[model samples]
Target: MEINIPKGGITITKLLLRICSILIIIALVTSVDGSKGNSASPEESITILFTHDLHDNFLPFEVRRNQGKYTVGGYARLYSAIKEQREKDPDAVLVDAGDFAMGTLFQTIYASDSPGLRMMGQMGYDATTLGNHEFDFRARGLAASLRAAKDSGDAIPKIVATNTIFPTDDEGKIPANLQALKEAMDHYEVKDYLIVERKGIRIGILGLMGEEAASNAPMSGVTFDDAIESAKSTAATLKNDEDVDLVIALSHSGTSDEKSKSEDELIAQKVPDIDVIISGHSHTMLKEPILVGNTIIGSSGEYGEHLGVLNISLDVNKKWKVNEYKLIVIDDTLPLDPTTSETIEKYKQLIQEKYLRHFDMEFDEVLAYSPFDFTPFSEIGIELKEEPLGNLIGDSFIHTVRELEGNDYEPIAAAVMPYGNIRDSFGKGDITVSNVFNVNSLGIGPDEISGYPLLNIYLTGKELKTVAEVDASITPIMDEVQLYVAGLSYTLNTNRFIFNKVTDVRLQDFDGTKEEIDDHKLYRVVAGLYSAQMLPYVNEKSFGILSIVPKTKEGTPVTNFEDQIIYMNGNQEVKEWYAIANYLKSFDKIDGVPQIPVYYEQMKNRKVVEHNSNLFAVLKSPNRIIVTAYAILLAFVGIVVLIITLIVKRRRRKK
Candidate 1:
């Protein structure tokens, strides 16, 4: 099928073919020279503006820290900071670790728009990991959030999770929840690792959720691989196969008080090939970068209080090094990105139109006044010991439950707050309803309310002692379960034998009266619904070393705690924030306005700590749990001694 072509046409075709060959050769050379098509050196320096554990703090908050008041955090301010950095160095990237969702009213629309991700997309986050809170609405909810983010037609970040071990054919039936999550992860191109070429620098990025974080996500059906192993494998792939110049691990594993237990630190030490680890979940603020072998790790504190800025440069040998590390404090002093501010306001309007309007709540209505600061982050706060903040919250629960449940509610003996549920602090100055909500931002029961509803239950005084015991024994493992009580005081001897840490438990009265708790008496107690459900699992978590049994004031056993849920405010859920707000409003007006009492300025001694764990000291007020714990310890020691003795005897006989 040969067709004769004209002489001029053939010459034109030959010239075109030669031009095409020359263009292909030039493209190959340009690619090989690492020329961002400019024949420049491949050595590139990058600046990273990183944040973690944002937890939906869309607006700057006026917070009192270290006896000073300042406004901190907000996407508007962060966007401006990121913008400045990017303008300075075009190679700069904005990234986050995880938990960018599920903290504020904006989280209510997670299943639809996922305004958090959308706003991040608008702010230009290059990539982000999934924190436990991202799955707070469950797998289906996460899927919807991702779908909405994609549908918005916005330039969204490349999401990644390196350690998610998806179910396989050999793993049996995949649960519907996990299947949905897997599909979303796939659709969003969430890979084990990503190689991004930014300004001639190939950066390898991987995301990980640590065991502690996985523990927090009880509803997330996905299983995660070991952080250390997964990180090492992914980093190796990036280095050996992809030849990336930098390996970055976005870890939601959190920093630990002990280096031995810290997940990110451990990864850094074990996987020295990783250049940087932007850690989250622990809410740790490291002023200086932690150097573990060749890797450097840093974490911005929880919320958007600070932006982590890191500069990385390559040495002559092409090995990466952190040139500078700074935790840039986000405050009102920083310029607000107008575009981002508008984006935030758009979500606020969405909150008003979609959810808050129905509840008759405005985002910034002043609810009360605080003359002093109250933060769980303090040394004596709920996260550690019982501070005045804990006392006020506990008392509020008692008062709110009594008012809403009426006389039939059997008078709550005390209200308890798990430290995990207390999110933000009450800063000195005008306390708005939003501020109150921030302090108590956590949980949604089956009713789908904005906050966890207050629940009342009855427990024997003996069970109260068990609760104290659990606090002492299990708190080191699960700090979130540390209980802050109102109307109760306990002296803890931390050095005492395991499961036998509390030395004294007494009932505290409003006038500072102290009386021994009657173990046989049944007393009503109040707690958030989520904490109430978790109360029964203490024994299981402790491997049956501890136990708790919730009951009714009538001495009847509680089979289904949910069935006994009492709705307040004419069938409205008595939200925790409302209880706190109502309680704050009840305070005496100081300076012609209701203010937090001056009493919180000083320690209330709710938890008197005596480190005397001597045998005599521990035996002072031993309850049944402590007595049993001692017996078990002694028996185990005796058995070990006997086994050794028998082995020695057998060895002597053989000899």
Candidate 2:
């Protein structure tokens, strides 16, 4: 991507002037792109325009907060802002930390042809790292997308992903998709580090994916090396092999707690020589560049919400020092660039004609009205506790699947969805199809469709309740992974043993009928495809301490649960957002709009919190799992008492 340094003769607006005075202009001078030391004095400065987690929000939209309504963040606004900054400092490098894809409907066709990457390339991104979300389409998908982008002949930026696990072992069968990905990674020249001479100074740039990001990218078939180790090795290569003056690490690791395992800040502390670390993956918005030793760490927030501008100057000692840092808001206040807007519209039209038209859906068509927010993280948020929104979704899943299937379909005892699957919350206004799309945007079906299918599985009542127990236990460890169940309400005794937290499991029906959950009875359950894949992993992630299994209704253990996955319609996987939109539209309209029933405006106590007033209360209505745990505890106590009694008898005999 080429940078156009505008001449001073160009017209400047008041907002640009204010931004220049407040955040843009810097006293320091530095040259951009080519040869070490030629024109600029040591006092000159260089600029780095950074953005992260854009997530395909190329159009500006209004966010109605409780305080007020404000428009924020789009390609046009961001382009205008970046152009203005470049006008002042022509040598500024535009780079994104990571996670620039796989959020919106635009990303649905990424594997075929990635418009997002093309747009970024057009926007003049100097370089960017591969974020966790980049792997959303899986190994072959990424390979295909990269190939597609290259084949498109768009001026895409340098995509650097250091510390990847290449997997060279020939013992077992390697998947074709994975093999294709490895080849594509090599063919595309996805590098660990690159040296670009900015003005007269050699700038060494390296990229690393953090541990969390690696974990999040389960579908990628690519594992990552240690973040610190990757950064250190790359820095060493750059400083020694390349002989660069400044070293920058575009780290998707992110700043985190000081003692946390591997974060951006930890990388900076461990790897000393990196000049600046642009952090990502954690979605942290650090307003000012954090100084750790000599390195400056900066991160902008997620979803094109903000742009980070970092200005640095060379000191007398020839060391780089941060002169300014701004996490500039990409709100409606900024003017839209006509060229970028035109490009964005072109893509939108293409998406409408090629994609949405098939489903009779428009990008911004209003589908329903929400009297209150149904967002995953709103007040009475689904993840915060058992919430109304979750209940609504769970109920919706059951309804949609049942309708899609014939009347003779096996009765589902309950339908459940993980809070992680529900992405965005609904605002207290008109809910558009796009809004619904935002809520459950992450999934792809077996048929290569855009959404995950709802799968039918069966589990013993004991195991079913255990699924809820997994929610209570894993919530603190994994944010938003908690399950929101529909068929039953389980009381959680926090004071009880970790894996044995849920109790009082009761089967609940849509008609409000309830019954005790039978321990031996196998009941049919429904879950989103993503949630189904994760069910087997919960026990593995918990170190096999919590043995969770979703069996068939006959109680036959499902070794390959993927085969059991069911589409709601004939060859049509359950598209979550579509299901949600259809469900909402099914609601009886008020004022000619399908108004949300007053039923969902508050919490739904699917999982009741039972504060253990005593040990007995904590262990009440113990399922087999809880009973076994309690027995073990009692046995341990009995053994201790027996030992104490023996010791006392011996002392008495001695006396």
Candidate 3:
């Protein structure tokens, strides 16, 4: 120690001690920073299981009458799949894209009380967006559904549609009922967006309603803003202000494989920050998630047939990227989770019992049907070529209109039924009364046009040709123009220009005999309301050759054709139509008539041309108001009963 007492020994010792002190301080600072980083790391990862466009398919295994096989899909099965995925990851998020409240009779029944949403809540859905069909009953129906979801207890899904604005009265004041509805929405927990946190990751989910919803459904008091603008605003808020790590848009609009303007695509392009877009409305099945820059778009096919699963991973920095994505075809191969299945079954029974009590009938009676079969055709089938279902629907519509008019005006020709509008079909067999109701279940009210008696008019052959041409020329136009017709016969030369395809125009009366037609003459026609809008073409046409009578036989004005026809077809009836189509097509001959071409070439495009006897019968009959009213009233009663029962049950639960 004495040896260390060299020159400046104490000073050197002091310097060494100071250097050690600095090193210790640095070490302490580094350890504290490390601890902070560890603490700041995201707590846990989450997987989101999403489904959309489930059009009220609560049971699986649709029996294929002709093939004698079973198709898989049902709420019970879907519930099981969701539960299994959730259990696998306790933090899994479940969501629905939209179009969850219409399509099947089940939906019509549950629309008012939202049995579907209640069931979804029980199944643990985090959020849901409003589809166009959500407004099928207009504001009243949507309000009721929001109410049901709130009363169910589990946080009701955030009813997020940024673009939809509630309208004010003439005095520029919000109506009391509407204000109450808004308050109910607030009380019931239906929000525009929801920030869900799991394992320390904040996920922002917003909803979008399709533009088509505003036009197709009765959104009289609500206005829908531009999709892109709404999306950008919502995304900006979530990302900048909320500081959300991931943003998901549940869009009711759809993306097509073909070249088309999609709301989802536009939203992605305009609002680039969104991480994922779960879409529906068009009911398209994306083979894989579509990658549009940083956004991943996915949609599960409609009717509960598919479950969309997306797996994502977040980095230590809290940035997210899609790790895996797939649309799982929900079938029997996948094991069904017991807990979810039990819950689904419980709800199913409850719904069934409630419906029965409301309807004063048994569950089986509600589902009972005769072995009737008819072919159902889509809009494409009618527009591109002659479809049996189209012909039948057109005929039924014309006959109904004529009967309502007291048989004053005989419809010379009918137009092709607009493709997407015809929702059901007629089948062969006993054709029970229920089947009739099912065939016409969409409850569009009666119209009161100004000019003529309410004669629902269909475009003539030349008019159809013109409309078709317009439909083809306008790239972004909707399919609403292509009209379905009945009691008319004409040749379509797809090779010709618009209005030129229709040649050899003649009327095929009820007796199947041809009647003369004057190209300039206007005859009373019957068609859907969507078709009536195109009637304006009569005024705008180059020829100025046609005029719409706009009156029924009873001299009533035809204001709203779509509203006039109520109760299209029930789900079972629709299935029956397909079954009949398949069955008839299978036979080499029916009623000694050779099976018509199920597939035909028109304008170089292949089309399905099938026929059904039941449809033919409906078309042949004169439309009687009494008959139509009875059918509609019966269907309405059924739907009302089901809805009331669900509402009462929900109220009881809340109490």
As for TM-score, the candidate ahead, 1 or 2, is: 2
The lDDT for every candidate, in the order shown, is 0.79, 0.78, 0.58
lDDT of 3 by residue, 90-188 (tens): 888899988776654455445345667776776678888777776665566567667766666654456666676777889988777577667656666
TM-scores, all candidates, are 0.84, 0.89, 0.68
lDDT of 3 at 106: 55
Clashes of each: 0, 16, 54
Worst 10 residues of 2 by lDDT: 30-39
lDDT of 1 by residue, 349-375 (tens): 887777666446677777678776666
Best by lDDT: 1
Stretch of 10 with least lDDT, candidate 3? 446-455
